[model samples]
Target: MPNCQTESHPPATTTSPPASKAPQTTEALQAEQAPVARDWRAPSQQEIAERKKQLSPDQFKVTQQQGTEAPFRNPLWNNHAPGIYVDIVSGEPLFSSKEKFESGTGWPSFYRPLDPQRIVEKHDDSYGMDRVEVRSKSGDSHLGHLFDDGPAPTGLRYCINSASLRFIPAERLAAEGYASFAYLFPEVKQVLPQSEPTSGR
Candidate 1:
């Protein structure tokens, strides 16, 4: 088994500050607002069946059946492009390149999700191994397992299955309706005009 088969533990509990004390940055506010605007809803059984037919065998297996792909053999394990990864089934934004790191685990690893609310973590005790499984909230797709061994600012690794995600490059975020996330990429932000030109007086 690869590093993806690592043991897991209960997710650490986190506390949020009271609303009055919580300060929201422009980017954080945008990220919180943008996804709701998309109106993502959980698919019905019928829709899931349709998706089963539509997705490739590997995608169906990995996402629907909770199967893991061979390490380093998947498409996105080594991807270094500036982009965000979305749930293949629901198009829900999951991880950003900003939080992604080379974990040498032969899997696409992220230190944190773009929006923590968008993912659901479960305690998985399958294969006689204790693990915390990560899944997309709306799609209910089995993404991969989460582990404690990773680099900071978050010492947790989201060892994801590449087949469960669809990459949206930084340059395409706006065109893909993820413009709010473009701020995560300095290059994208630099090229984006901060304000329109003023008319000559």
Candidate 2:
């Protein structure tokens, strides 16, 4: 037998096969872009944001439980100035300096609100005692209890929880999305001015 050292012959044609196209993805087939993933943490940051979801746990307790903010611990008690106070929970305008009073209670006290309709007074008997409760109309945050010791005019002292308020100064009212309330005080100076005019010129 004769051994033949011969190599196998190659194919006559030496052309590469065409590449197959990639399959279309469901995402590509859809006309619209995919939606973003929802952030579950969103609700946590919205407490003090004033433009999003509900208040955080502590804020809810202080603002909705009629809980007292530690005296001298709140940011607004020492303000000693003029401004509008809104609900910290819902950001609804509630009290203005025009109705604020010095109650000597170490809290922001208001003899009356710009509008009585803004507050919803309810009989609160939670503490084994009958008391008048004050809450914002839109937010329903438990503003401190209302007392009858207020000065003349409304005579209803709304002793509010500082933790339940977001103050906006008279000058910044328009910038803080409260321009419509500008009309509440025709003379802004007369409302939150450093001092009442000695004599109007």
Candidate 3:
């Protein structure tokens, strides 16, 4: 008997296939390119309390207690300067001087807020009258009442209280941490000095 021992064949090498990437959906691509959302949440109770402590009695009343300031007597009511109004409590941009107009309401009136999303409107049924009340989205400050009696276009009047706002003058926008809005004011071109009148002599 011939004992023939056949050599076992060497095991074949195995290789893993490359992974296939799944195609991105339209929604995913859109989300990736979308701008990051801003943090607009309200402040904590402690922060609110601290802000209240720093506010004047009038400011505290209008923002915290939802009280109204006298129409013609409040500051900023007749302010016609180029600037933006911010939340007294949260420093959130609310309205711009360009939107403000003479509404004869004796209060700071605007056709619309700087950003409509920054304002929260609610049905205010107090005092036996139905009115739309506007509030700061982040600060939750009671701005004032909104009425339909306004100029063309929006036909909406935001009759806001001056006490609930802090004005950031255009000249001081950068110094006051609002430099992003500095574009609202363009630099005034210097007029060339008039030639001396010696020619007339």
| C-alpha lDDT values of all predictions | 0.74, 0.58, 0.68
lDDT tens per residue, model 3, 71-181: 567788678888889998988888888778766556778766766767888888876667778898878899988776655445566888898999977777666666666
How many clashing residue pairs are found in candidate 2?
A: 0
Clashing pairs in 1: none
**lDDT over C-alpha atoms for residue 43 of model 2:** 24
List ranges where model 3 is wrong by over 4 Å: 1-45, 188-201
What is model 3's C-alpha RMSD?
A: 27.8
For candidate 1, lDDT tens digit of each residue in 1-201? 443854323222222221232333222433543343243345676876677678889999889999988776889977878988998887788988876777666778886787777878889987878988999987899999987666654566789999999998888777677776776775764233355779997
lDDT of 2 by residue, 112-169 (tens): 6655655787888764666777887666678777776555544456777777888888
Candidate 2 TM-score, true structure as reference: 0.62
Q: Clashing residue pairs, candidate 2?
A: none
Segments of candidate 2 deviating more than 4 angstroms: 1-57, 184-201
Question: Tell me, what's the RMSD of every candidate?
Answer: 9.7, 32.4, 27.8
Q: Where in model 1 is the C-alpha error above 4 Å?
A: 1-3, 6-49, 189-201
Q: How does model 1 score by TM-score? A: 0.74
In model 1, the Cα lDDT at residue 154 comes to 50
